[model samples]
Each structure stands twice: as C-alpha cells, then as structure tokens.
Target: MSVRPPGECTAPDRRCILVIATVASFLTPFMSSSINIALPVIGAEFATDAVLLGWIQTAYLLASAICLVPFGRLADIHGMKKIFLTGITIFTLSTLLCGLSPTVNALIALRMVQGVGTAMIAVTAVAVLTAVFPAGERGRVLGINVAAVYTGLSMGPFLGGVLTQHLGWRSIFLVTVPLGLIAVALTLRARGEWSTPRDERFDLIGSVVYGTTLLALMYGLTLLPEATGFGLIAVGVVGIFLFLWQESHTESPVLQVRLFFENHVFTFSNIAALINYSATFAVSFLLSLYLQYNRGLDPQAAGLILLAQPVVQALISPAAGRLSDRVEPRIVSSVGMTLSAAGLALLTVLTEETPVPYILISLVVLGTGYALFSSPNTNAIMSSVEKRYYGVASATLATSRQVGMMLSMGIVMMIFSVVIGRVAITPAEHAPLLSSINLAFMLFAALCVVGIFFSLARGRVREDPHRA
Candidate 1:
C-alpha cells in the first residue's frame, strides 16, 4: 500500500480545514438550484422560449464539467489555495454580473463564467479535505461535507422563492457576494500545506478537446426535443467519437479513462452516481412546476414542500457514512438506491388532488434513500483512488455528477415537451400538465431502478482500505 504524507497540521486543525472546505463546497449547488425559482420570472422578462430557458441551467453544468479536470490538475501543479481563491473571486464577480444582466444572452454568458468559478472550487474541495483529514476520519469528514451540499440544495428553493417574491430575483445573486467573501477569509485562516511544485504540465489540448466535445454533446441533447433533425444526431455522434479519440491518445488525459477500465469500484460508483443524479434532477426540476402549476402552491410553498427531501438527507447521511465504514459500500449503496427507487415509484400515483401528507411522505422516503446512498457511494469512490490521485478521482466523480444532471434535465425537458405538444393547450392547464409530470416521475423512478442495479454491481472493497 502507498501511504501519502499526511497534512502539515494536527488533527484538530485538520478538522477546521474540513469545515472550511465544506462551506466552500456549499456554494456550487446553492447557486445552481437557487436560480430555478427565479427562472420563470426571468423568462417572462426576457421573453425566453422553453428551449432557450433550458440554457440558464445547462450553461452552468456544461462549463463546470468542462473546467473540473483542468482546475483539478492546476490544484496539483500550483496550490489549492491559489486556485480556490481565484475561483471564489471569479464566482463572486460573475454572480454580480448575473444580477445586473440586462438581457437573456448576457445572463447566460455570465452564468457560464460563474460555472467556471464553481468548478474550480468544487474540483479542489474534496482533494483539499482528503489531504487534511486522516484516512480513518475521511468518511466522517466527507459525510459532513456531503451533508453541507445537501443542506445547500435543500435551502436553495426556499431562499430563492422568498427572495424573488420579496426582494426581487436579483437579490439571490447579490446575497452570495458576502458569503463568498466570508469563505475566502476562512480559507486564508485555515492551516494546510501542499508539496513543492513538481515537473507537471497542464494538458491544454486535452482540455480544449474535452470541453468542445462535452459542449457539443450537451447542446445536442438540449436541442434534441425541439430540433430532432439529422444535424443534432450528427453533432452528438461526431463529438462523442472525437472525445474518445482525444482521451485515448492524450498523455495526460483529462478524464483518466484508464482508471475507469482498471478500477471496477470507480466504474460502478460513477454509473450509480450518474443514474441516481439523473433521477434526482428529473424529480426536482419537474416537481417545481408540478407544485406550482397543478397543485396551486405558491413558489414559497412549493419550495418548502420540496425541502422535505433534503431535510431527511441531512439527518441520515452521517449515519449512512458511518455504516459504510463498518460494512460493504455495495450493500449500503444498493439498499439506499432501492429505497429511493421505491420512493419515486410512490410518486407515480400523485394527482392534482393528492394529499399534502402523502407528497411529504414520498419526499421524506426519497430523501432518506438519497442520504443513505450518497455518503456511502462517495466514500467508495474517494477511497478507491490513491491519495495522490485524489484530485483527479474527485474531479472525475464530480464530472459524472454534472453530466448526469445535465442529461437528466435535457431528457426530462424533451419528454415534457413531447407530452405537452400532444395537447392543444398551455401548460397552465392543470390536467394535461399533471399527466405529463406523472409520466416524468415514472421515468425518473425507472432510472433509479437502474441505479439500484449499478449499486449492486459495485463489488465489495474493504471500507477505507489503504490506497496504492
């Protein structure tokens, strides 16, 4: 086993570093979904179509995926602190620009820049935390970090709705400015050190090629429902091939395709993550509309109701992580995914007149399942790689997550568009919209079922085993 050098600080100091890193990680998801509640208002203001509206979220996901690998490598080359601070600065500035954007085009452009900043922070966070914490404590520290992420995701809708209703949608972006400054201050105060600079070089060509490929594929996916022309298919197929070729030949490939082949644990964890996230993305995105349009819930009520999932997730994640440290991650992850799929299946019976209690129960079940699944699953992924390669490993996992989310959004939108197109009426008409959302939920459940299979396939590894 290859044991990397521990962090410079003592255990207590390392704990502090974990706290700081967790806080920084929170910014990404908080910003990502907080904007969802505001999309309607923004869409109306900009006269954006459904297809163009999708870009608001897609731009962020695409940019983040494109930048994660390169930023991770940069963290290894220079220092995590330098790259992290730069990212925070950029994120804060771009958020301000987003708040002030006068047009849809400008807002989309600024969001892409914001996503770059988010990617930098996100890609570095897990590596930094792993470096600070000892192997034995890694699972707990990561669990807390995961909890923070879910907390942010849970709070996003409520915050967004409240702010948009009272303070205007722009306030959502404005609020992050101070939080960003606070995070920067804390990071500076934290104590941790990296090794001396090595003779490493960034793979600029690989980064560009990978970025272009992901952009093309994501764009094609986004456009597929509206424009099912041959051009979209051609772009997706060609882009995917080029991406594969680039990764195969590059000396320092961005994605580390070899790792996927050699490590069964890594492969299954990524597959499970992708499937789980796709289901999550579909449910959250569609449910927001379902609550508001079909059930006559206001944005604030809808947000509050959605909070059920994250609240339970926060409650159960630590326990799940601790359990994984004792048992096989495959068992924990498989059971969790199964529970989540069941919860989503329950949602298939939802109707416009469904009781609020039933909806909350379903959400709680989903949240519990997610909490159980996420921490253990992430622990498996992070533990599989050598400590020195934590940066790349974490980046790959994060990229998988973003890709899943982006794909889920695209697929859900496509399905919704098709379902709605068959009806000669607007989405504001309750019955047709409810039917569409029901179908979407059923599709999401099916994806979760696939996650269960992948989770089961993740062969057992010694929990927190020494890395090579």
Candidate 2:
C-alpha cells in the first residue's frame, strides 16, 4: 500500500477515515471515563480497597502504554486498516469478557487485554487521519476528532452514571459492545489501507526491553514508599537507558529515538502532553469518590456534576484546533496550560465544606484549559513529523498520554497507600481520603504550572518544518 499524498486523496475518502477515527476515538475514552464513575460501585461489589480499585484503571493504562509503540511500528510495516480491524475485534471481545468478569482480579486482567486492543486503535486512528488530510486541513480534522474524544468524555460520566446507577456497573461496559460493532462495520466498508514504503525487520529485543522497563517503572510507582518499589524503579530507569542504547544499534527500532533529540516541537509538545494529562487525568477519579463518599451524592447526580469539564472541552476543542492553524500553537497551548494550573490550584482547597458551585466553576476552568491545550498540541505534534513517521508519531502521542495517565494514577495510588492505606472508603476513612485528594490536587497544580513552560518551549510549529 503506497501512501497517498494529502492533496491526492478524495474528499469522500477523507470523510470515511474521519468517521472511523472519530468512532474509535470516542469508544476508548468513553470506556475509560465511564469506568471512573463506576469505580466506587465496583469496589463495593468486590469488597476491595482503594489501592486495588486504582489498579482497575492503572492496569489498563500500563498495558496500553506498553503495547502502543510496538504495535504502531507493526502498523507502519504492515497496514493501518488491517491492524485497526484486528484491534476493534480484540477490544469488542475483551469488553464483553470484562462485563462478565466475576471477580475484580478477572476484570483487571481483562482490562489489560482491552488496553492492548486500545493501543492498536490509538496508534492508527490519528495516523490514518493525518495520512489522508493535508497539513493545512490537519488541525481542523484533528480538532473534530479531538472534539469527538471530549464528547465521549462528557457522555461517559452522565451515561456511565445512568447505566451504573440503574443497570449496574456491568452495563457500562456492555453498552459499548454495540458501538464497537458499528465501528467495525464502518471500517470494513472503507477502501484501501496505508503503510510505510520501507521494509525493515522489527526490533524484537528493543520491544521487550521497552515493555519490561515501562511495566517495572509504572508498577513500582504504585508500590511507592516501599524499598522494593524504589529498587524496581531504579531497575526500570536503568533498563530504559539500556533500551534506548539498544534502539540506536538495532536495524529497525520500535521507537525512533532521534525524534526527541532532533525535533524541539515534537519533544516539548510531548512533554507538555505528559504534564497536562498527569495533572488532569485523575481529576475525575478523585472527584467521583469525593462526590459519592464525601458529598453523599448518587452516581447519577455526581456524574452530572462531573460533566462540566469535558463538556467545555468538547465545545472549545475544534475552535482551538482551527486557531492553532493561524496562530502559534505554543502561545495558545501555553495560555491553556496556565488555565489548567489555575483550575487545579482551585481544587487544592477543596474540603467537605466546599460548595458544589465552586467545584463546578473550577471544573469549567480546567476544561477550558484542557480544550485549548489538547488539540493545538496534537496539531503541533502531527504536523511536525513527516508522513512516513505518522504511525510512530501518533503512537508516541498516545504513549505519552497512557504513561501520563499511569503516572497520574500512580500518584493517587501512592498517596492512597500512604494517607488512606489499604482501606475501604468507609466513613471512618473519609478524613484521610479528603486529605489525600487535596494533597494530590496540590501536586497536580504545581505540575501544570511547570508544563506551561514546556508548552511554550515547543517553539513555533509552522516555522520548524524540519521533516514536514
């Protein structure tokens, strides 16, 4: 499958790709955010503690982060549509199995498989979009795709809450099955596939080292305050360095290491994404518990309250993405990061006495910042790379997100281990839980403040067309 230049592709072809990408984009985030609303119910049903409950999300993120790059490279070597179809099948089946999981352990395991499926879809969806659309129109389509993501996020809490409240937590996972089938049906009808022209051997050794090290690092983060955790983190860090060195020597690497050192826009944009997601990803997770346990709200009401952020994001993303095409992405994204810092800072003061309106106000601020940051930053990343590297670039973007989400959860898990310990969210543990949530928000605010610098440091995307 030789690649088609952006100008050469037909409008209908672009529309088909966008439809597939949009559905895929919506599906994964919907599952993730909806599950956040169901965590309390899941914990209650299974009689699990906070740390174990965190694993429900963390395990999926870890698996997706581990597989994204390898599967992305495979897509580059083979075909995006083939991998995309396979992923949809895997995701649909795994999601079905997840709903049937009788134990928390079984559910967690299935989520890992679901994550693997997610990795394939995550890597290809954006790459395919970038592949079909011209650079001038990239941000517009990317914004639309990103808006779809926010739509899923916005719906996740409300729909997830309704399903969880009325139909049980299992319904939240089961409902996605029909949507998955629809995506598969649409994708199968799409014509042609995309792949890199170059033929290179896959680097088996680098993939193993990369996967192993990341697993160790993320798992270690969850086990924090323990000497074993520190030891494993040290090993993971060292192993990553070794993996990079191996990539430099390998004939064909899973990750193209040179992209980071050579491309300022790519590197800093990715860094900004890491920091932004790290600061913001766990906001819903913490608040879901806070609303249910601390504020004594039902899942339905809590979800409506939680919908403020992503709704703002869904509304603003396309405009911001289009704006980035005209202005400097760094400037627009930096301002967004600043807003995020402000939002997270507001949440740091949250307590049982805090008003619901205050929380909603803070969420609106955070969502605005996220809306500004995500689309333009993504536009910068995809635009900075050449067509041949789209799969890798897309996967790198998704990997940054998964790793950031994993770290966000890791931060929460470590805090839980230390502040709340391995305890259920009984009224007895409420005080400690509040303390933990407040402290986490404080750290996240500080992190977002730092991310503003990186967002600016990514420089101008339009000027630095090094490869694009």
Candidate 3:
C-alpha cells in the first residue's frame, strides 16, 4: 500500500488534509444555518408548537456537546483517520434519513444521529489538521478551516431559503448528501492514522457523567423560571462538580479537567469561546424570524439580508488566523469580543421599522468580530496543549462552542415560552416576539462584554513544548 511518509509534509498531504477537513467543516454549519431558515417552514408543515420547534436546533447541539469529548478521546486512542471516516459515513447516511423523515420527531431523532456523527468529525478534524501541519503554518490552515465554516454559514440561509421556498425543506437535507459523499470519498483516499498508546482504556463512567450532566443542564435551561427547571439545573451543577472530581482521579479520563486548571490560556480561551457562541448562535435564527414575520419578506430576500455577517466572517477569518501566528492571540481575540459586544448592543435596538441597511451593517460588524475571535481563540487553545492532548484540546474547544450554542438556544426557548407562550408565530404575535428578540440581544450583549475580560485574562500563550 502506498502511503505518504510522515516526513513528507510541505505540500501534498497537507493540501489534501486541508481540502478534506474544509469539506467536513463546511458540511455541518451549512446544514445548521440552512435548517434554521427552514424552521418556520417545518413548523408550518407539521403544525408544531414553539417549544418543539426550538428543539429542532437544541437536540442536535445537545447531543453533539455530550458526545464530543468522548469521541475525541476515542480518536486519540484508536485512530483519527478511522474515527473521522466513520463520522462522515454516519453523517451522510443520517442526512439521507433526515430527508426521508415524515414527522417532526423523526427528523429531530435523525438529527441527533447526525449530531453524534458531527461530534466525531468535529473532535478529530482539528487534531488531524494539527498533526499534519507544523505550528508555524498551523494558524493559517486552521483559519482557512474556520473560513469554510463561515462560508457554509454564509451560503446556508440563501441556499436553504431558496430550496425551502421552491423544492421544499427536504431538499435542504437531500442536497447535502452529494457533498457529504464527496467528503467521505476524499477521506477514504487519505492513508495512515493518528493515535497514541493504542491501548488506553475508554472512560465509560466519565462519559456517562459528562453526558448526563450536560443534558440535564441544557434541558433544564430550556425550562427556566420553572420549579423543575431550577431543580434540574441545581442537580446538573452538582453533577458537574462531581464529574470534575471523578475526572481528576481517573487513570484515563474522557476529558482532562486538570488541563483547564493548569493552562490559563486553554481555560480562558475556551471560556471566551463558550461566551461568544452563547451570545451569537441565535442571531441568524432570530433574524430569520424577524424578517419573515415583522418585515413581510420572503425567505429568499430575508436570506440575502442575513448574508452580510457570515460573508464578512468568511472573508476575514483567514487573515485573522494568519495574524494570530505573528501576534498574541489574546489581543486579537479580546478586540474581537469588544467588536462583538458593540454589534450585539446595536442589535438590542431592533424594531419592526428597523431599516434594511441598519441590519446589514450590524451583521457585518458581528461577523467581523466573529472572524477575529474564532480563529485566534482556536489557535490559543490548540497551541497551548501537548501533542498527545491535541485531540482532547480540539474536542474541548468544539465542546465550548457546542455548549454555548445549546445555551443560546436554551435562552431562546425560555424567552419564547415566557414571552410568547408555545404558539406558532403570526402577525399578531409580532410585538411579543420583537420584545423577546430585543431582550435576548441585550442579554447577549452583556454576556459578550464580560467575554472581553476573559479573553484578555488568558495572558500570553506558553510556547515552550516542555511546558505543554
């Protein structure tokens, strides 16, 4: 069997790795953004309630976060290439199943399957990329990978809106099938594996603890201001403390809790990521609703207006990534948080009469801030770890992002329940919906403002491999 030698790293294998990783990176966000635009359509067809509609997004993110760290550890033990390929196969098949789903529950279930697949891919993708490229070039490639994510986001709404408007929402899932197949095929061509020890015991107890705790916490958040919600949340918090204690003692923990305590950069970067995502993931979802419900625009036109942010993100992420390699990631990421906070604060003033240009400008500001924050923050986390810890570190960062996404959605769910109740959105419901959106933006802005300090508190990255 022909294999690319480990020593041969300048171009051939590196380029191939980037292409495959970029494709995988693009696939999930495209599905997510496109699906967010289609949520109203899906609700209309199924006659679903608001709470269940929110679950369309929440279930996937919750599952992905719960499984990410475990899958990352498995990849570290078995082989990244194998795990990554398996994830692609599962994702492609699940996407097919999603297209064929006949009910809302069925679609949500298959999305959970897809979420498991996503966790696998997300955990290994960066680890594989990091393994292929040296540190000097790592930030550049990672930025490009991040750019592909934004590119998917950039196109998802427009493509999803068009497809949903014309061919139906099922087509959104169907279209991804071809792209996913190509990713699987490309991954198949790659040779070799990335795993260490080859015999580390899988931490089943830790996995159970982590997954249950997250599920409780996120699900509880969705039910906020309720008695059971508070109960569940309190239990979940205690569960987290217990999980940390268990991990500190485990011989082969699913996640190394100690890393967060030991590495300030890794810890704070992840904290910033969590806050940034919590403050941002729902922007597209909320805006889609606002444009369609309040502005009386079609999905296609609304998608075009919503395109401003991610387009900027796609264009600028690589440059920001490259910039991190030269300067301290903290400075760039902190500034990004500041910009993000400003943009979100602007969004708090949104009203039914808010102009098209104003919305576009806000998206641009938010996207630019995201571009600056994401790549550099990611660089800080990945670079701060040992080579053997790359898989876990990558998974941890992905976890932070996914958890934040879940929290973002949870906040939306709680607000909708309290403000609008569990009803389908209509013209008459516009005022309450607008109120909810405004309040959400205000809360997010405040959260991101706090993220600025965390981003800065990370201090300088420790570059010494020995320290890692």
- RMSD per model, one decimal: 4.1, 2.7, 2.8
CA lDDT of each prediction against the hidden true structure? 0.77, 0.89, 0.87
Residue 386 error, candidate 2, Å:
4.7
Local accuracy of candidate 2 as per-residue lDDT tens digits, 349-403: 8889899999999999999999899989988998898877766777788889888
Better of 1 and 3 by TM-score: 3
* Decoy 3 TM-score against native: 0.92
lDDT digits (tens) for residues 98-176 of candidate 1:
9999998899899999989998888777777776667888868876887778878878989888887788879999998
Q: Give all TM-scores, in the order shown.
A: 0.87, 0.92, 0.92
> Lowest summed lDDT over 10 consecutive residues: which window, candidate 1?
420-429
Give the number of the best model, judged by lDDT.
2
Which residues of candidate 2, in runs, are more than 4 Å off?
A: 1-18, 132-144, 188-191, 194-198, 383-391, 462-467
lDDT ranking of the models: 2, 3, 1
